[model samples]
Target chain A: MTTEPRLVEVRKNVLKQNDIIARALRDRFREAGVLAVSFVSSPGSGKTAFLEKTLTLLHSRYRVAALVGDLATENDAARLGRSQVPVKQILTGTVCHLDAAMVQNALDGWDLTQLDFLFIENVGNLVCPSSYDLGEDLRFVLLSVTEGEDKPLKYPTIFNSADVAVITKSDLAAAVEFDEAAVLRNIQAVRPGMEVLKISAKTGEGLAEYLEYLERRCSSSRAGAAASN
Target chain B: MHELSIAMSIVEMAQEESERCGQAQVLAVHLRLGQLSGVVKEALLSSYEMACEATPLEGSQLLIEEVPVEVFCPKCDGPRALGSIQWFCCPECGTPTPEVLHGKELEVVALEIEE
Candidate 1:
């Protein structure tokens, strides 16, 4: 009888390295007292616009920086840089999602202690970004009114993975006949009692609450770190 | 898609594993893909073939075992395998179960190396 192939047991999680790096980054963020947040959504969901407004608004109060990821271009970084915050772009180059290594590398010359908040704008895709955690304290998933209301139900994994849900393009909700209640219900069904916020970046509506939320998280995180020390 | 990158990583792992075993030829790679892993098996299979070319894992098969979604049902006080993909509720008591017990795995369990 012919010899059989040798069976070797190699139990390894493919994303273990990414997870480890992300953990380290999270610890670093904690120690440095910087609140890091990330945004994930499908393309055309207005993440860039929302971030630009946030940067412009928050820069007056706190030291903020941004790292944006994309497959090819630096266009998003360019747009956000108009807010006058330190912005950098990580070109993924054929990669659909941003890993922790990329985030770490992008932060290379910057001192985390110098900033109160660091924003990572992930490449606009709901599916892949959910799997890769870039060491963010807050992960926001955006859904636009123009998109269907069932997006949360259809993509439950991303919604479940996210800390909060953002309804973008709220100014056009009535114009597009978007079903606000149904979308809220769908989000709640996928992730029960998940916080949902409606905002129009163009009109600056609901941004005060968003900024307040960020301020609360940053202050609380800093306070927690101080207490631990 | 990201499957291509994932497949490339799998091929890299297989090649490294082969080298560790004194450059043994890899016959196949066994993977545990969960339903909640967010990876499409068919796309990964095709990407694996493309990724294996010119590598030590060339011509090796990527055998995938799909893991269905399972949840720890608080009401049932046990784990229940989802009957369908649509809803993620307890099958026994019909309660929403958000605590996932399984189906998020993406691991390389074993490999079939040439003897």
Candidate 2:
């Protein structure tokens, strides 16, 4: 005998697995007193160069490391390894974005306590990375001047998901005639009150301010952990 | 692009639920997809069937409910429907709100199963 079809309520989140893992990672980061920063952007947004500069700048004074994700090849990881810090390459092999599980796996066996700052550079893709949270304390969405001022508007979900917006390749701003005000307006439209920073790793234009801001955030997180302990 | 993986997750979840219900055949799966979730509905629709292949969910219908982005406007003091995905301002009073009230949902709300 055939039975009738009935609707049953599930009300379950599709990303529940990833979310749980991300929460655990967040807690681990907090307990370990480390500031985790993740970067997302389209291909050729200068995320690697920016991260390389950041890691190099912080390597002398602090314990820092990086995990860079890519579809294939360890080219980025090799480039970042030149910073003389620990670097891991996550080859996704076809996965468009890095999820919490990949991050948790990449960080396995590492002592989070020894690290002052951990940087995760996501597989370069604006669309897919927005959906999966990698459990980073801060998500920086990078936008180069050559990519156009409307990049934020074109990819609003990513802008909304990110904590900060970095306009990279400022050294080519005039060559590309990048309109800073227009990009600012676009970012404000998608994510109101998002912290935006313009930096050019090539010439060390805004790295000092960005580095100081990062150090401040790291110190605050460490202080928070201390107070709690 | 990642919808295939997402679809696979949905199928896995539904399969487990179906098994819990004495291995009932899932006739249809109801999903709530939000605009701000960064998932394209059409992409998911195409990927759903592929994900269900060789599984109990094969040939089952995937019903999707699109959820629009809503933000809590400070000036309005209420939830406002976002005018556009790119614009987070209230369509009514034009107040910009950083607080997102909803539209991030990607959930399996219900399942139609044949007993």
Candidate 3:
């Protein structure tokens, strides 16, 4: 008897299942007239703080809910829930990022058509989150002034993947000696024609602009979907 | 790390493939990894071993083929391989091009198995 090991051709994407689920989620979100948005950043980039403020600000005007992901704790979901919005925490345990399956599972029992906007705050990591699209209409990538100006250039993939780049903790820019020009230049260098925003959730500075942007995003996304349909 | 999850996914995929091939023993899983795939090769390889333990892929090998980034350059009127990581620009004309032609692959291409 002869022993032989044969090579079998099985060409398939490892993430094909995730992609299919994500596409279904996106279609459902669009049909329900809900804007699904996500936020990603490095740890301590003020994503939770910014989301807390956003939830509070938009809660009165729109039916808002959030899914917060963390490696270990539900602290972020607890904090965001204080705004009195439906908040759920997806504890990924050791996973560095949230996938579409997690997002879909978390939305169980909730009618998406009832909400105007649904936010998913991803696990605080710039690299991994970029690779996983959670069926979001828009993704905001956050960077704090304290992180240094070259952050976007250092992690260009995240910057390139995000629909918008947010500069958080603007109120502390002066104290931290943050160079706005350098940061802007770096962002432009890495992802040209990228939309950037500056905001401070603590002081409400630029919050108005941020909200307006969100409103515009919701409307435009819905309008685009309606037109395409 | 997410690499562990991805490694598990690979193992699961291998098991399915083996089952489809009449319960053949998978000797190795071949993968095509791209630079833009966002997975660190070393981390994934280490995670693969751990994920395979106590599973059908326990002694199997993961063979990875790294794909280089390629961009569609309008200035060059064609796609070009990015030689360096400094920028996504056309090497000949130095014009920035965001149109990616390749290097996002994270596919399981083949399997070495024995009946």
Candidate 4:
């Protein structure tokens, strides 16, 4: 049977599956009034250290849980478990990034209403993670001082996708001769008016301010204090 | 990178679309890939062949149209194509145009199928 090929109009998002699940998760988080924050950064950018510091510090004041995604090991999960808060490891195997379905599955059995903060630590990759959204209220992209000021320019897509840029490993800024001004300029060049913060988990410097900022932003969001009002 | 997974998603979508059209065989998929979509066009094109293998969409071609980064220029009060992804500014007026109007598309706009 000879047949001609026909052109079919089918406009669809390639990531529609992930987007659908992410939307559901976002709605769930909104209804439960939980601020879900996701971290995306290149490898060795201090994502784990910063998160460990954050979870430990916020444990006493608020309910916190973490879902850490890695390629194969549960090492990050084990380290985060030291904070004595609920922590889970999602082994992505060969997957370079964590998608929304993985997050939705990992969050099973955990009551969102019981938690004030749920942090999703994505796999340590710059390019891939930016394509997937895990239903987070805030996406903080980390840029370490050791990585140089051109990091933002090199990975502008990820920077544009993130809500805030955190300058990590600031304690070594003096030794590395890190140019804060240039880094800030590159960040602004890629993403104009993006909020930026600097902190060192090692010295606990800027941790207090970061925590305050996190809480303040959460409350101001529609899911944060709308129920109370 | 993640382009393989993205290619797989496109193949999956094509299969479903073909099935909807009376078990038609998909010949090609037309995709609108923006420069700022965080996806590399070359990588995706290379991965598409592998993704289509062992599937109903085998031998299907992925025709991609690259969309340039466009930002809403607040000063100009109109859309402007950005010169570079690193710089989010209006090309003519050089205004800082943070509002992105386009160039983030990862959509499959059309498909060629044999019924």
Candidate 5:
């Protein structure tokens, strides 16, 4: 008998299971008619403040819920709860970023069909969050005016992966001498034809336009799903 | 860093693959890491050691193969390695190319196990 060992060729992505779960979540969200939006940014970029403003604006008309992720402390979740909408805190402990598994676990026991919008506030870190998809219908990457305008260039992967870019704290632009034009240019350079919106959560500026854009996206996706069905 | 998390995933995948192959031990895991994959190779290597401790993949080495960013330059009518991340101009001629052929790849290619 010839002594030969069989060599098995197995080519698979380590994140294959995670990707499958994420896809399932996406389909579930679509079927439930929930417009899921997620936010990712570096710490101190006003993500919590932005979400607070968004919840305040959206809760009046739409049934909105939020899931905020952080390394520790429920300060953000507590703060967002003031909006009088359902909010959950995902304490990742030592994890630098939130993954799909975390998102799914956080949503446990909550009826997604009851909500029109779901916002996932990812842990404040730019690098790691871009690698994992949390099954959100839209992913927004936020950059503050105080942050360098070349942030998009420095962290191209985050900007490239984001569906939309939000320039937060625009009220501080003039005080900080922020280069708005350069920031826009850098965003375009990294992801051409990407949707970018400028907003100031403190002053309530540009909030209406952002909401309108979100409404349009949700409706369009709904139309597409209807047609496919 | 997120390297630890990635390393943990690698170890888990290796263990599962070893079990599927009816092997008692994993020798190594081959990974294809592209230049633009946004993963630091040194950090990953160090984290791999820490992540594999007391796990099935203990003592298993992580073999990484680096891949350069390649883009299709319309001017050259072929693919060429991008020297830098900032500029994607043609290597042979001075022309900007918008087509991306390779880059941003982070995947485990294969596993070596003892049967």
Candidate 6:
């Protein structure tokens, strides 16, 4: 009799492994009382500019660190490092998006407990970044007014996945004839009742509100974790 | 392209499954892809060959089954297929529905391998 090998049916998501690691990282961040925030946006949307300004503003009050991802180049990390906050650059090589594996690798040798906030600046792409969860407590999606107000309608998936939407480069709004009402309406249409913040890294307008929002979210999550524990 | 990375994951998973079953080679991988999954099928197919090389899934074929977006119509109280991602209106009653029943799926459902 010919022996037949038994077929084992295994229906598991390839991303499940990454999810597990991400969940663990989230728990670790919670325990360490670190507010981990991530950013996703298209190329040239002023992510690095906003991040540099944010780091400079928050550096005095809280310990902040950042990890920047790109297909190639440490330029972003180098620029953000000028703010004098610890920064790491993740080179994804041929990969178009930043996965949890890359984040874990980048965080190696760093003490999570030392920092009050960790910002992960994802690779500048609106599409692929939404699929990977990097265990951040908050996700900020940036859209510059110069890009157009209908960006939310064009990239619903990214907007749907993000917790907060930030309209960057608001200083150029008047010059670019940016329609604020239309952008807000489009954002609400895609993600109903989502929080939207308008800011200009150059002028520092509305940066205070954004920081307060971050502080509120961080504290709320901390309270929730404490209650659960 | 992101397709190459996705293809690599598929190949790795297929290889692991083949080893578990003591299979000599993987013949095909069955995938269910939704129209709104944000994955370009043509790009994925092109990258699959390159990603699968030097792996157990080498020469394996990807069998993609397209899944249409199904939404629940509030006006009609019935399920309807979405023609496009932009338009979420019901074809029967022309009422807009935001509740999605099925779509945005990218999964490998089954594997055909030779023992």
RMSD of each: 1.8, 0.8, 1.7, 1.4, 3.0, 3.2
Q: Tens digits of per-residue lDDT for model 4 on B1-115?
A: 9999999999998888888998898889999998888899999999999999999988889999999999999888998989999888889988876788888899999999987
Evaluate residue A132 in candidate 4 and report its C-alpha lDDT on the 0 to 100 scale: 89
lDDT of 2 by residue, B1-115 (tens): 9999999999999999999899999999999999899899999999999999999899999999999988998997998888898888889998888899889999999999999
| Count of backbone collisions in candidate 1 | 0
Model 5 lDDT per residue over A87-148, tens place: 99999999888889999999999898898899999999999888788999999999999999
Least accurate 10 contiguous residues by lDDT in model 4 chain A = A220-229
Interface RMSD of each: 1.7, 0.7, 1.6, 1.0, 3.2, 3.7
Task: Using lDDT, rank the candidates from best to worst.
Answer: 2, 4, 3, 1, 5, 6
Residues A1-229 of candidate 3 have per-residue lDDT tens digits of 6469999998999888888999999999999999999999999999999999999999999999999999999999888879999999999988889999999999999999999999999999988987787999999999999999989878887787788899999999999999999998888766666789999999999999999999999999889888988
Write the candidate numbers in order of decreasing DockQ. 2, 4, 3, 1, 5, 6
Better of 3 and 4 by DockQ: 4
Model 2 chain A worst lDDT window (10 residues): A220-229
- In candidate 5, what are the lDDT values of residues B11-76, reduced to their tens digit? 887787788887556778889877666678999999999999998888888989888878777778
Clashing residue pairs in candidate 2 (N, C-alpha, C atoms within 3 angstroms): none
* Candidate 4, residue B30: how far the Cα is off, in Å: 0.5
TM-score of each: 0.94, 0.99, 0.94, 0.97, 0.90, 0.88
| Top candidate when judged by lDDT against the true structure | 2
Interface RMSD of candidate 6? 3.7
Show model 5 residue runs off by greater than 4 Å. A1-8, B70-83, B87-101
Interface RMS deviation of candidate 5: 3.2
Question: Candidate 1 at B99: error in angstroms?
Answer: 2.4
Instruction: Name the better of 4 and 6 by lDDT.
Output: 4
Q: Judge candidate 1 against the unseen true structure and give its global Cα lDDT, from 0 to 1.
A: 0.90
* Per-residue accuracy of model 1 over B1-115 as CA lDDT, tens digit each: 7898889888888788888888988999999998878788999999999999998788899999999989888888999997654466777888876777888888999999875
* Per-residue alpha-carbon lDDT of candidate 4 for residues A137-193, written as tens digits (9 for 90 to 100): 999999999998999999999999999999999999999999999999999999999
Docking class of 4: high
**Better DockQ candidate (2, 3):** 2
